[model samples]
Target: MYAPQADTRLLARALHAERITAGMDVLDVCTGSGALAVLASRLGARVSATDISWRAVMTARLNAARAGQRVQVRHGDLSMPWFGRTFDLVTSNPPYVPARDARPPTWGRSRAWDAGRDGRHVVDRICSHASALLRPRGVLLMVHSSLCDAGATLTRLEDAGLRASVTERARVPFGPVLTERLPWLRAQGLIGAEQDWEELVVIRAERS
Candidate 1:
């Protein structure tokens, strides 16, 4: 199971800054461990969380129960379980690591961090579709690494007719995944030989 990390903590901090209120509808996509879901529930939002992994879904449900928070946990692709529904707020800390493979393992813990070659596999999906899942005046708070191209995300959200901007950012040292891929990433020129840090950024998009 994917445990809470810097990206998760950063997203939770950003959600707190959103000032989520009681009864506000909140959806947490790719809700690994349901860290964000629990945080939102604690803040009084009517929270729902979704994950493609059955393991993650069960883990999230258990975490919610252990935390004494009521969260609707769904098992499916990102946002798929919420079709025809709109939320006041949506938050995600999706897998944004640029992986060596075209897709993550079909059944493994790697699903929590492996994105396609450019790491935009899931991020692009969220950028293109999240706006459609939001109610009017709804806001989406998503966190990803700058290596995934934050500019592209901003542009995509804007193209989707949502006002988007980077709301929070934190520099974090390379975790095990990135550290393991350092050689390949350096060969690809995605990172310099001396680079050992990645900047995590939270993008906030609002639908008018």
Candidate 2:
């Protein structure tokens, strides 16, 4: 399972900054360890979480139970399981790492972070559909690496009629995966030869 990391903490902080309160319906997409789901539950929101990984789904369910929070955990790709449902808040920390291969790994732990080519495989999908799952005035809080083209995400959300902006940013050292792929990333012109740090950003989009 993908453990909670800096990106997770950052997204959680962003979520809290939105001042989510009781009675809000929250959806945590790609809910890995369900950290965000439990946090939303603790904040008194009715929480639901979804993940493509069965292991992640189980982990999220167990985490919610341990936290004494009731979260509906579903196993599926992105928001496929939540058709016809709308939420007050939608949050996600999807796989945004650019992979060497054109396709993400079908199985294994690498599935947690491998996104095809430009790293927008899953990010793009989230940007395209998250607004549809939100109620009026609903907010979407998503965290991803700057390497994935934050501008594109903002534009996509705006095109979908959501008011979008980058709400937070932090420069962090490269993690193991990124470190291992530095050479390839440089060759692909996705990163500078000397770059050793990456910027993480949280984009908040609101439905009017």
Candidate 3:
């Protein structure tokens, strides 16, 4: 299961800032350990969460239970389980690290963070489908590394007909995974030669 990190914390803070009232529905995609889902439920929203890994699903369920919060946690691809349902709010902290592998890992610890080359394997899909999962005027809060290009996310969300912007940003030093990828990232022009940190951004998009 993916442990909560700076990206997750950033998303959680962003979610807490939203005006999520009682009875409002919230969906948390790529819910690694159900932290955000439980938080949303604590805020009085009806929370449902999904993850691609069964381990993560179980972990989320366990966390929710321990928190005394009711979160409907399921094992499925991002947003796949809630196809026909639209929520008042959606949240996600997906895999956004640029990786050596051309395709994201389907199984293993890497599945939690190793996205394809540009680190958008999951981000792009979320951008494409977020609007569809939200009710009119509903909101989507998602966090990702700026290495993937927050600009692209904004463009995609706007093209999806939702008003979007980077609502929060935090610079975090590179961890082991990123530290190992420094040379490749630098060669790919995803980071500056001396860059040892990444800027994480929380994108807020609203359905019109």
Candidate 4:
């Protein structure tokens, strides 16, 4: 039971403006509702999308079918099975909510929103494999809450030898986070107490 929410419009704009063309290889990791993959298919790209959640995978397939597009949606862990497959483009909206109990209720307590105890588990893994997943000159696009450390993400990606940048920023309200962890984040200097409680960021990077 998924809704028809499409890929974030900003993401669509980036894809459209970029070099994605017919017959190019692409993968939309996370593939929630398959919106990005569907859009890629419409651009004539041979797209494959994967999600760990069975419901999300099925929903993506249904969404692609509804749009009369052919996107290969598979139920698999991020970047598995297709380990050796490099792509012209890879995208994801990873769970970066820092901690399971540290997010607000608007994020809905789903595993999809939580990023384990540190909120970096999924994203860190994505960055770890990004270089190997992309073709030469290929790109990786990801969005995460500012609650997570965007800089660290970029740093790790760069360490992997990929050219990374913050391509976009949006002040979307993510609702709220657990109050108990506030002191820890502040003490760790990861976030300031005066910082706005709700915000998200989108980052785009390219593989060398």
How many Å off is the CA of 137 in candidate 4? 0.6
lDDT of 1 by residue, 167-207 (tens): 99999999999999999888888888899899999999999
Instruction: Report how far residue 87 has shifted in candidate 3, in Å.
Output: 0.2
lDDT of each: 0.93, 0.93, 0.93, 0.76
Model 4, residue 82: C-alpha shift (Å):
1.4
How do the residues 135-197 of candidate 3 rate in per-residue lDDT, one tens digit apiece? 999999999999999999999999999999999999999988999879999999989998889
lDDT string for model 4 (1-208, tens) is: 2332222665776777777788899999977778888999999999999988888888899989999999988888898957789999998876666653544223332656667656787888999999999999999988776667888889999999999988776664324343556666677666666864545556778877
Off by over 4 Å in 2: none
Clashes of 1: 0
Which parts of model 4 are misplaced by more than 4 Å?
Answer: 1-7, 100-109, 176-197
Error of 4 at 194 (Å): 5.8
How does candidate 1 score on lDDT?
Answer: 0.93
Better of 2 and 4 by lDDT: 2
lDDT string for model 2 (56-139, tens) is: 999999999998999999999898898889999999999999988888887899889999999999999998998789999999
Off by over 4 Å in 1: none
* RMSD to truth, every model: 0.8, 0.8, 0.8, 4.0
Please report the TM-score between candidate 4 and the true structure. 0.83
lDDT assessment of candidate 2: 0.93
